[model samples]
Target: MSVLNTAEIMEILPHRHPFLLIDTVEELESGVRAVAKKAVSFHEPYFAGHFPGNPVMPGVLIIEALAQTGAVAILSQPEWKGKTAYFAGINHAKFKQKVVPGDVLTLETEIIKVKGPIGIGKATAYVDGKIACIAELTFAIG
Candidate 1:
């Protein structure tokens, strides 16, 4: 496991504070694939209003986490460093389960195809070995 701590991840991604979702990277293949983790906590800001009593991690945030994981893999390359990956689009996104506090979400993303500044990645988020969300993410390097 080539673990990247929060500091390393912050270096690769521009997100911060309540926006940066990924906690640690367990695997990375520079522009190829990556596996990361996000320890969901009840104290997360969104839980305060996402639902008053039954707080649930938003599905869109799961996709964002996946995208960030992919960015770590893509931007880690010497040629792509310092570049930002924008959310071009999302396809076939599906939510299989609700993610709540105390769940450690394992996020995996693999770059399936790329062309110039455009790229495609297949992403999935899992909790307790069960699939929580899956999607085909499209991004553009900026």
Candidate 2:
């Protein structure tokens, strides 16, 4: 149910393996909103250091996934093509549940405000329709 797969996402965002957290983009509205997915697997390299026995997907990575989702929305636009979205700040970030291997993270980011190269997005990450994390992310196009 994805509009853009990994191959397509790579073309828009300058990201690659080990760091590239998004798997598929399900919905996109140019610069308005986006929904993306990340399949968390036990084989992910981050699991080794995140925890020795009880592995939990890092909250920061979840936020990064949301950022990538936002990037997909912005970068898909005609005027923003090839531009990089840099993380400016994060506000009101809250983690409600722990995300583990075998979980599919559905990340959604909506543009809440925009002005020139700077903007803010409201983002949320969910697992099985349950909220995992929520935050307001600020970014700058470079």
List ranges where model 1 is wrong by over 4 Å. none
Query: What's the TM-score of each model vs. the native?
Result: 0.98, 0.99
Clashes of 2: 0
List clashing residue pairs in candidate 1: 31-73
Where does the lowest 10-residue lDDT sum fall in candidate 2? 71-80
Q: For candidate 1, what is the lDDT?
A: 0.96
Badly placed stretches (over 4 Å) of model 2 are none
Q: Give one digit per residue, the lDDT tens place, for model 1 in 1-142.
A: 4489999999999999989999999999988999999999999999999998999999999999999999998999988888999999999999999999999999999999999989999999999999999999999999
Candidate 1 weakest ten by summed lDDT: 1-10
* lDDT per model vs. reference: 0.96, 0.95
Model 1 TM-score is 0.98
Candidate 2 per-residue C-alpha lDDT over 1-142 given as tens digits, one digit per residue, 9 for 90 to 100: 7899999999999999999999999999999999999999999998999998999999999999999999999889989999999999999999999999999999999998999989999999999999999999999999
* lDDT score, candidate 2, position 88: 100
The RMSD (Cα, Å) of candidate 2 is 0.5
